[model samples]
Target: MIRVVAVLALLRLAAITVAALPVQWVALRLGSSLADRLPVWWHRRALATLGVRVTPRGTPSSERPLLITANHASWLDISVIGSLGPVSFVAKSEVATWPVFGLLAKLQRCVFVDRTRRSATGRTAGELGDRLAAGDPMVLFPEGTSSPGDGVLPFRSALLGAARAAILDSGHTRVVVQPMAVVYTRIGGMPIGRADRHRVAWYGDMDLIGHLWGVCIAGGLDVEVVWGEPQIFEATTDRKALAATLETSVRDQLRAVLRP
Candidate 1:
């Protein structure tokens, strides 16, 4: 355990010291394509170092102007999902102000929304539309928060408004909304029950430092990422209905993994 934690600490220090600065400079000078790819590389390395294994079941949409709506489980979800492809996230504005994570989010070019302001969605939607049109796959956690991993929470439909904005702002007739689910299935090659899985979830009043320590010690953590069938968001599409469809797809996928 001590050796694993030491290796992880060294890996983080090396990444921040040796790789992060140069990668940031390259992404800023070149463009977002490089920015998109660098995070995937970093995330894969982090997962490798931490012994977290990810099994991605389905493909992310190849369609341009894509919005992938996923259920959130833990802070590790970012690394698990990021390792899959060149994707940016629709994160809450507060994440942009966090310590090391804030810097990482900026480097990844995540779109930050102030969820407190009801009026902000329209403006964020415009930004999301522009990003989607530009060929960036944007990930939105419609649940708007992490869950306990036992089950998914009800998705907040208001965030799905960005899909509507994509159609209107980008001049696209339709946008593809893909549903995704992330589930933690095992630790040390043994299946984790609901009671044990909560230890992997970083929610509520959990302290970030403590959770980081716990994750470092948790061995052979296995996660599954499943992408559901894509839905088209058209001008006439109902935002609430779209959100409900995504929620059901994600919930079903998660339940599949939790089942024996």
Candidate 2:
């Protein structure tokens, strides 16, 4: 199983290396259509090759200025969600420095925010607003950190301020704020207990390489993605209140997935 996982990982690396450069060049010279579509193709392949089965509920909103707020469990959340469409992400600025993952995020045109800089919030929000206004759906993990997948952490409402920025910057009366949930419900065709589920979660001080290797060898993993009803974010909307609403919806969805 380890050998199989290693070979698959290498093959994925090779595929990304071969396809990413050309796709990025085309996206830059032409437009984002190729860049957007190609990653979905790659992610789908990666999901299958990694032996992850994703079952998504409800579709992402087609409305412009869409911002998806989701719970963070592990890095696998990215691939599971990316497999859905041509969406980009709002990631921590540090991700920009990660080797291959960083490059991939850049190619996907992710909006990176420096969470430590108090003064950078406005600037980051403005950037996210610009992306939203441009019709690029952006995803944000509002918990500010990954969780253990047993439950959700309170959503940090500060970043939700970007929705207001989008409304004002774009002069759009309304923006769509979608609540999404990613739950690891099963492993090896059986319902996973809490202790077992932790194997799928990458949090605390877990080493990335070790986690990745574990995930590769852990076949028959099943993840369920639930998209809550899209809410409206207006210029007058209270960001923290809106964050609370999304938190409730995501928790409900997560509970549903984890229920026996």
* CA lDDT, every model vs. true structure: 0.83, 0.85
Off by over 4 Å in 2: none
On TM-score, the candidate that comes out on top is: 2
lDDT of 2 by residue, 43-146 (tens): 88778877889999988788988999999999888999999888899888988998788888887888888988988888888888888888888999999999
Range of the 10 consecutive residues with the lowest summed lDDT in candidate 2: 161-170
Per-model TM-score, in order, reads 0.93, 0.94
lDDT of 1 by residue, 109-224 (tens): 89998989989988887788888888788999888888788688988887677657655766788888999999999987788876786668888878887787677777669999
